[model samples]
Structures are given as structure tokens and as C-alpha cells.
Target chain A: MTAAATGVRATARIVARDDGRGGTSLPVLEGDGPLALRRTRGSGDEAHVMLVGAMSGPLGGDHFAVRAGVEAGARLRVGSAAATIALPGQAKGEARYDVRLTVADGAELRWLPEQLISAGGSDLRVTTHADLAATARLVLREEQVLGRVGEEPGRLVSRLVVRIEGRTLLDQELDCGPGAPGGWDGPAVLGGHRAVGQAVVVRPEFEDRPVSARVLGEGAAVVPLAGPAALVTAVAPDALRLRRVLDEALKSLG
Target chain B: MSRAALLVLADGRFPAGGHAHSGGAEAAVKAGRVTGAASLEDFCRGRLHTAGRVSAALAAAAVLGVDPVRLDAAADARTPSPALRATARKLGRQLMRAARATWPSSELDALAREFPKGAHQPVVLGLAARAAGLGALDAAYCAAYESVSGPASATVRLLSLDPFDATGVLARLAPELDLVADQAVEAARECVDAGVDALPAASAPLLEISAEAHAAWAVRLFAS
Candidate 1:
């Protein structure tokens, strides 16, 4: 019920509305408790909000809650300057973040948060819940690296739940770890690859896309959801390779 | 409650159409994640705790008289893969037919009518357990066993792995199976007052991800 009960409490909120000149502008820009948002230059109907971490990063025993909204006839693009590096806190526990997003009628939002780098002794949980109107459109991309550039993978978990017009569309929980938190092997999860990315596109009355379950290149594959969602989970030997795979997925998503 | 009924439900040859799907093992085998018996054991252990654990909880909750529709939504929330979701509903239909014939119950008939297309496999498994006069623990056992048994049987055919080794893998997992089943029933009991959110949502994304890849395989032996 309270942020203190969970851990160190940190929160951010962003509210954007239409500007009448065929674009959108941020009217409620607030952050930096732990996450800071900056407006970036953009063209056409796109407005970018780049996230900046205020602290060294999320340490163990840290809690973050981010809330964003796109009003009617507005377009909002969400991204970050760099990937997040999760480290253990003084208490040596898990860091958790809860994200709540809303897309009003005729609004569009693109969420492409950078990959998360999980360090050893790190336990991280990120959950995002989206409420969309029937005429709203959303593109959500979440990527994660199990361990640091060179380290043993820690326990990382993320859960996403989306509701369109009060109807549940996507509800999934993913855990990445060395063991215990649903340990990974060569076969069932990432196939020995330490990186995975999941993307979803929700648009009402959208036609079926040709992307099904096909490997993008060496270690990347696109796992298409039944409806408008395209679930892509790609794994590479290293983080660099994983970034390439994520880039390819972005193009494929295009 | 009838242990015989639990066995009848847990039996691999229960005619629930489980034989058609490899439970994502086919995908893992092709990816070389499950090369032999050892890796397969690891895979099964992860499943027994994650997806398998979640399924057992769902079944157990159903046996505890939780609303099937709400449980079905919770199942969707737990399952992130579209392919696996489809497989679950298909298996639910198959199990419902067997349940209607083997143990006639008005509840089963009504479930069949409501979810004519199908609900979810775990939800149906739980209802079937209730109809057969089984308890929550029995339902958990039935669902947990199927989670591993389906893959173990499929591996013997997919990689031509030694059948004895596979059975040995199951044997090694017997203790863990008991622990997970017990945990599932304990969680189910709380749902009686706390609602379906009390159910565990643990999942293996790779299993759901690989199920998609397995579904796209035109030459694969298993449907999922």
C-alpha cells in the first residue's frame, strides 16, 4: 500500500496532450525522484521523452514507480539515453519497479526502454500495466541482459499486463536467472544466450502480420503473439550480439 | 477423494490429446537446449517449479471451488505465449470430452457448454478433479506430473534419447514433484478468501517463446 513498505520509494509521472497544430506537447513533465525525463527534439507528430537515471542506478532494495499518459490525438515516444545497470544495494536484495501507462482514444505511444544490465547479486523485478482505449495504438519494446558485460547472471524478472478497452490483451511474466528463479538452460528459455527482448504492438482492427516464429539471424527469433502482438525473444552469445538482434527486431517491427 | 481418480487423470494415456504436443520440448531439442538426459532433467526441474508449479496451482484452485471463468483469466495472465495459450485451450477441450465420458458430472457438462471452444487445460483439469471427487492436492499432482511427463515422453521420440534415462530423470524429480504439488495446494487454499491473485504466476518465458517457434515448424512432429 505504501512505497516505504516495499523498499526505497521513487516515482515519476509524465502527461502529454495534443497541441492543436497537429502535434502533442508535454504539459505535465515531472521526474528525478529516481528517474528524470527530458524532452528531445523531434519532427512531425512524434515527441520523445528520454529517461535519465538520477542515482548510480537501482541498487538492491530500491523501488521505482513510473506513470505516463498520452491524451487524445497525441503521440508520445518513450526511450532512454542508455541501458540500466542494476547493482546490489547495501542490504543486498532485489530492486523492483512498477510502470503504469495509459493511452486515451486516438493516442499513440512507443515505449522502447533500453536493455537492462543485471549485475551479480542483483535481483530485479519490473512490471508494466497499460490501459488503452479502443482507438488507441501502442508499441512496447522491453529488452534485458541477464548479467553485466562479463559476469554471472543474477535474478531478473519482468511482468507485462495490457488491457485494451477493458479487455485483457497481454499478461506475461518472464524470469532470467542462473538458478532458482526459474533457472535457464540451453533449450527451453534463451538457448544459452544471456539476452532476451520482448515486443508487442496493440492496434484495434489490425490485420495479421506475416511475422511468426522465425529466427532473425544467428540467435534471434521472432515469436509472434496470436493477435496484434508480436512477441520477439532473441538471444546471442554476448551483449553486443544481443544489441544487434534487438536492432534487427526494431527494423522488423517497422 | 479417490486416488484412483487422480491416477486416471494423471495417466499419460488418459486420451486428453496430450500426446500431440511436446510441451515445448520439441523446440528446445531442436535448439540443442536438451541434448541428452542431464539437460532434459534441468529443463524439467525449471518447469516443475515455474510453469508446472503455476499449472498445479490453477488445478488445485479449481478443485477448491474457485470460479472457472476467473481462473481462466488468471491462466491467460500467467501464460504469455499465444501458441501455448492455444495449445492449452485445445488440450482443455480434449480433456473435457474424456471427463464427460469417464466421470459424468453436471458441472463438466456446463463447463463444456460455456467454453465450447475451450477454456484452459489447467482449469479443466481442476474441474475434472472435482468431478471425480478428488481434492486440491490430487489436482496439483495430476497437473504437475503432466507438465514433465509430456516432455519426457516427447523427448524419447524427438531425439531418440534412451527411454530408461528419461524415466530416470522423472525418478530424480519425484521429490521435487511432491514439494511443488504441496506448495500448489497450499497456495490454492489461500485463494478461497484472497481471490485468484493468491495463485502463483511463476513462468518460464523461454518455454512460451519456444512454443511459438515449435508451432511454426512445418516438419515438426509435435503441434506445439
Candidate 2:
């Protein structure tokens, strides 16, 4: 309950720069506590990195963060080894995870993390902020599973904010599980669905020829933002179905 | 300033083009999620806390003298569906015309000139409230009440449900409307200092997804 008792305060930082041979390389890879970073093999101009959870955490009171930057002409792809599960801990305070990403001009970043499962009796808050240059390309995806199989959810609040050239492209928050405001799981909100996911694609090419807005399926939709980006949002009865909806939408975006 | 202004702005027949849109209720009804008064109440409650809360906060902020341009951008940020954004702007434009003709304030005129096409409806609603001499809480109440009322009224026509039942739904939600309006005022106060980022960002994913689908409906009763 106290600030000191609130778990670990750890941050992982990564920097990707141009290799000058038509490729990209990571010069800075640092992670602390349970937030482990590993650079894996990548082909061509893209560098691949996988986030390996050093330990089971993001439990109650735990504080974690990941920061990544891609310089001009460099490309980086980040993924997780497995799903990040929020678990209840000894402390009563909620856990916090912050992801800050930056892509400079002519740079590219693909941030595709696995689902975040909010287990029963656990509480977590996640904030992901991405700042991109006008010419930067980004493919960011987020998926959340309310609770494990045959379990009730705790509390999970997630916020996603994306900006380009100092202008707001998209900013939204979703609060689900226990203690959230009323009607969150009702017909107009989740409609009894347990899984929710969204993908955002931004490219300079979209500025010239924008993506048309349309409904993907019964539970998904793709809509163009004010900037050169498109957002796909989908909700399903389960994670597998949710991924199917998002994957189908991504293929159409291509 | 005057309490009567809230009544004028919140009236369903204000000619702001809200009659054509069901605020996502049409899609819910078609999806079979809303079968009767009970389901309608459930749907309206969800909408009120999410989309309704966001709108009330924006309107309250506008009445508190926050810049309309900034609030308009903030509104755009909260609304992900292009169809919903277009609908908001169209309604904002219509409300701007009515407000300018009725209240005739310089701030409203300036905002109209700035956004020729239109701004977001909540921002315009706040300015309209201010133009009519209403306060922040009043603007918040108007926005919060309208969020549920629009859908309730639309459902009566969509399902041919008894009008009395629909009215009862709104009546039962009156207490929640007061609570949401108070919360909106609190958020608007934060916006006055911390900027629009302080406003609530609660979202209704099903509504956004359904609105996109409804927009493509070759034949539908409501516009959104």
C-alpha cells in the first residue's frame, strides 16, 4: 500500500541505428529486473528483438517500462516470448507498465507484442506512447484478454497514444475488469466479449493514397485516422478468434 | 448562465441532426443485443459511461473557456471511427448554425469561421451553452443527459417499443446522469489546467465497430 512497498521500478532501454550496409543494428540493449531484452537474428534491413520475461511479475505493486528508439534509415522489430500475465502479489497496489517508442524520419518500427492476460485478483495499468516523424513507418499491435479460462478478471486499464509531427493521431483508453465504470461489459461496450485487440498502421504512402474505411467483420473494423494511418479494432469471445479478426484485418491493410 | 439554456440545448428537437442518428443504438438493436426495455437500459448505461462521459467532459471544458480548437482536436482523438467523426462534425455544424442564430455570441462565430466544415459536437455544445449564458455543470448535464436520451428515443422508433417504457428508461437513469455530469465537471476543471489530455478517454469498442458497419448499411433506419 505504501510507495516503497509498491514493487520494483525497472526500465529497459533499446536504441537501433543504421548499420550503413543497408541494414540496422542495436547498439544499446539494456534491461533491468524481470524485464529482459534479447537481440535475435533478423534478415535484410530489419533487426529483431524478443522480450524475455526474466521472472514472473507485473504483479500487484510492480512498476516496469520499456523504451525503444529507431534512428533514421534504421528498422526494428520487437516481440515478446510469451504472453504477459498480470498476477496478484502480496502488496495491494496496482502494477504499472509503460512503453515509450520513437521512430525518426525514414525509420521503421514494428511493435507486435503478445496478449496481456489479466488474471483474477490482479490489477495492472499499461500505457504505450509512440512518437513518430512525418516520414516514419509504424505497425503497432495490442491485444488484451480480460481473464484466464473460466476465471473472472481483476482490473486492467490500458492507454494508447500515438502522435506524428507533433500532432495527435490517436489517443484512447480502455478500462475493463473489476472496479471499472458501469456498462463496460454490457451490449454497447464489450457485449460479453472477453478479448479485445487493435492494430495501427502508418506510412507516408498512405498520405498520398489513404486507406478506405470499412467494417472488417461482425466484431472488427478498420478506420482511417486524421493523419496517414489506419486503425483496426476487434473484439471476440476469445483470444484465438480475436487474433483471427486482427490478422484478417492486417492482411487487408496490406 | 441561465438554467433555461440547458433545456434549450438538451431538447431533442433542437434541429442539431441528432434525430437521424441513434448514437449506436440502431446497430445494437439490429444485433439483437437490445430486445426490450431491460436490454435498452443496459446498452444506454454502457454508452453513457463511455462515449457519454467523454462528451460531457468536452462540453464542460468548452463552457469553462478552454480553447474550442484544442477541444475539437481532443474530440477527434477520442473518436476512432471515421463515420462517428463525420457525424459529430456534421451535427456540430448544424448546432453552430442554430446557436449563432439564437444566442449570437462572438466566440461561437469565431469557432464557426475557424472550422468552416464544422468542429466536434461536444465542443460546439459547450460553446453553445456558454453563448446561452450557461455554466460548466449545466453544459455537462446537457451532454450527459443527451447521451442516453438520444438512444432511448431512437429505440422507440427502431423496435416500436412503447414510448412510455423508453421514457421510463431515461427517468431511471436520471441519478446516473447527475453523477456523470458531476464527474464531467471535475474532468473539465482538470482540462482547464492540465489541458485536454486530462479528459476521460473511456471507449465503447462495440459501438465504434458497429458504427462503421452501420455506415455501410445499404438500408438502415438511423444515419449512425
Candidate 3:
């Protein structure tokens, strides 16, 4: 084997608790390596957290993880300041980013990370998993841009798995860019689109009256899941249009 | 395993209710993406690899004695679109009728009873293949081939193009089909050890997106 950089391994954890004074408290806020977590102001009782990059290079061969937990009656929203770029590094191994989210009874979590851009000559595989209690609520959004401007995309594989109680809500994996299966850019797949986004909203109220399936606009559609959740998937020629489609779909979902 | 049974299971006219759905080709055709044989070939190839790959692995795993209930849940997890899920179950229900009449296996009957509305088509297909004395590879081949063949035939009817051209498209994709089927079987083997998470989850976003749109069409030639 050729000599190469071993890669960076980082883990960040955040836990939101229901404070007695009608607000949420972050009793556990931890960060390591390139994953920097900071607690910012949130509206009302919600606790907001922003992910700030401490350094570049989730490049090839990196291992990163983020775990967020919301206790009963707590509300937490997580977002990133900017898009995370996956770049090629000295090593040939694929980068790994795993996100684990948990919402307790009567808790709510909004995971709205910015888009992750896969740059040329990079390989990144991301898996996001969320487990919710029966009465929990979650809004999770994921957007991926295949490549930077004016270049072919590297290999990118992303999977999102969400479960409520003990039942699966939505589980899907999208593989794209170079070394992916053929026809990924074909009409039936991305249709020459370089950006793809999905948003999953879960609320207990949906159990009584589920959301109807509808197309938000061109390149986007929202459909209710078998569980008390609705999933909106959108693809566009670029990141801007993709975000727009998801925004409109979220509005309609609201 | 019976080689002839594989052929019978893979037959297009197997009365599985697949004829009503265009497999997303109707939307692609209306969008002017699949105008003729060349574009249809491209479209079929896309389905063959993404959706096709996933379906084949699920089918192959089902043939490997995986629990039908768990496999059905896995299939549900893989399919994000409700319309496509409904179509798959509808086709699965229809295929269940055809398979039980032909093979009369207890597994198929039990699964049918469990999912009275229907299980996913790929899961039913694997059970059907098992009832027909076929192997995992055979199930995978059938699933992968149908992924492309359905779109091709649908395009033929939607565009009213020559059937021979559609057949040719399938012929050209024969080698890739074999490769995908083999990959699916390999993944299925891993699932036997590592669980359903080992199965490939490749998805075609456009197909899932357009299937929702196609389902809302006021007047459409195909069901999906």
C-alpha cells in the first residue's frame, strides 16, 4: 500500500434539556477536531445551535460524527453557517460523516444543515439517522450539490434514515458523481441536474389527518410517508433552484 | 432451480398488472426527454442501474430466505414516493394472485395474507421466484430486466414507436443487466450476514419526483 495521510476523526455532541423557566437548556455541548458547535439564540423556547467549521478538509479519508439529543419538552434547531465542501486529500479512502439525532417524548428537533458540496476528485459518504419518540416532532433537511462550478463531480453517497417509535418512516440512499452507477445523470434519475434536496417533516398531528401527496413545482414533489411524516424531494440544475423548490415545498407543508 | 421457471417468471405477459404503469417513462416522454429509440435507450439504462439495481438486490435477498415482513419493510424504506409504493403494492397484489395460481406455495400465501393490500412488487417477485424453484440470481435478473423492459415497452406504446427498437434497447443492455444482476446477488449474500442494510439503496431522484407528478395527471396513458 502506498503511504498517505491517515485522516482526521472528530465527534461533536449536543443535548438539549427542558429548562424549568419555559426555555431549553444545553446541558451537554461538546466539540472535537474540525466540528465546532456553538449555542446561539433561538426563538421562544427553542434552543438553536450553529455548526462552525474549525478547519477545512473533511477531504478524503476523514471520519466525522455529530450527535444531537432533545429531552422531553425540549426544542432544538441545528444549522450550519456555510456549506461543507468535500475535497480530495492525500489519501484515497472515502470520507465518512455520520449524524445521529434523538428526540424524546414531546420533544422537537429541526435539523437544517446547509448544502454539502462535493468537489472534484473527492469522495464522501454521509449517513444521517434520526430516532423519535411516538410524540416527538422532527424537521430534517438535506441538500447535496454534485460538484463545484465547471467541473465533474467526485463520488458522493448519502443516506437518510428516520424512524418513529419502532417503525421506519423514510430510508433512502442517493449515489452520484464519478464511479457511481451509470445513467445517474439520465432523465429518469437526476435529469442532468447537479443538485438534489430532501426535507422530512414529522408531527403527531399528521397521524389523524395525513398530508396529501402533491407536486410542489417543477423538479419537486411532497408525499406523505407511511408514518406520521411527509417527505419532499427536489432536484434542480443548480443549488439555488433546488433550495427554492424545497423552500416552496416547506411553505406548502406548513 | 428451474431455468424454465425463470423465463416464465420474467415473461412480460405474466399478468402481474405491470402493463398499466409506464415506470416513469410517461413523464419522461411528455417532458421531451425520451423522444425516440436513442433517448429511450438512455432512459431505460438509467432505470436499469439505479432503481433496477435496488429492486434486484431486494428480490435476490427475498429469495435467500429473508423474512418477507422485514424485506417488505426494507422495500418500504427504499421507496420514498407514495405513488410508487402504491403502484408496487398493486402490482405485488396482482402478481401474488398469478403466482399462487401457478406455484401455490405456502410462503406466497402467507405473505399475501399478511399484506392483503399488497407487499412491494420486488418482494413478491422474490417469493414468486422461490415458489417457482428459482435461485437468487434468477430473481435478481428478473427484477433488473423488468426495470428496463417496463420503461421500454411503455415508451413504445406512449410514443407509438416500433416495438423492435424497444427490444433492441433491451438487447443492447443485456451485458449491463448481467453485471447488475450479479452485483445484486452479491449484495443479497451480504444481506444474509449483515442484514438488509447491506442491500444497495441506489435511488433515481427524477423517477421518484416525476412519479408523483404523473400520478396527479388528469389524463395519462400510464398509471405511473
Per-residue accuracy of model 1 over A121-165 as CA lDDT, tens digit each: 888888899999988989887777878767887778787878777
Decide which is better by TM-score, 1 or 3: 3
Model 2 Cα shift for residue A131 (angstroms)? 0.8
Measured against the native two-chain assembly using Cα atoms, what DockQ does each of the candidate structures obtain, in the order listed?
A: 0.44, 0.87, 0.80
DockQ for candidate 1, please give it: 0.44
Worst 10 residues of 2 chain A by lDDT: A1-10
Worst 10 residues of 1 chain A by lDDT: A178-187
Query: Which pairs, if any, clash in model 2?
Result: B1-B133, B1-B134
- TM-score of chain A for candidate 3? 0.97
Best by DockQ: 2
Candidate 3 ranges beyond 4 A from true positions: A1-4
After superposition, candidate 1 runs with Cα above 4 Å error: A1-7, A207-228, B186-198
Q: For residues B59-139, what per-residue lDDT tens digits would candidate 2 score against the true structure?
A: 999999999999999899899999999999999999999999989999999999999999999999999999999999999
Candidate 2 off by > 4 Å: A1-4
TM-score of chain A of each: 0.89, 0.97, 0.97
Judge candidate 2 at residue A232 and give its lDDT: 95
Model 1, B1-224: lDDT tens per residue?
66788778888889899999888888888877889998898888878878898999999999999989888888886776667888999999999999989989998888889999898999999999999999999999989999899899999999899999999989999998999899999999998899876788775657866676667777989888
lDDT of 3 by residue, A89-166 (tens): 977699989999999999999999999999999999999999999999999999999888988888999999899886
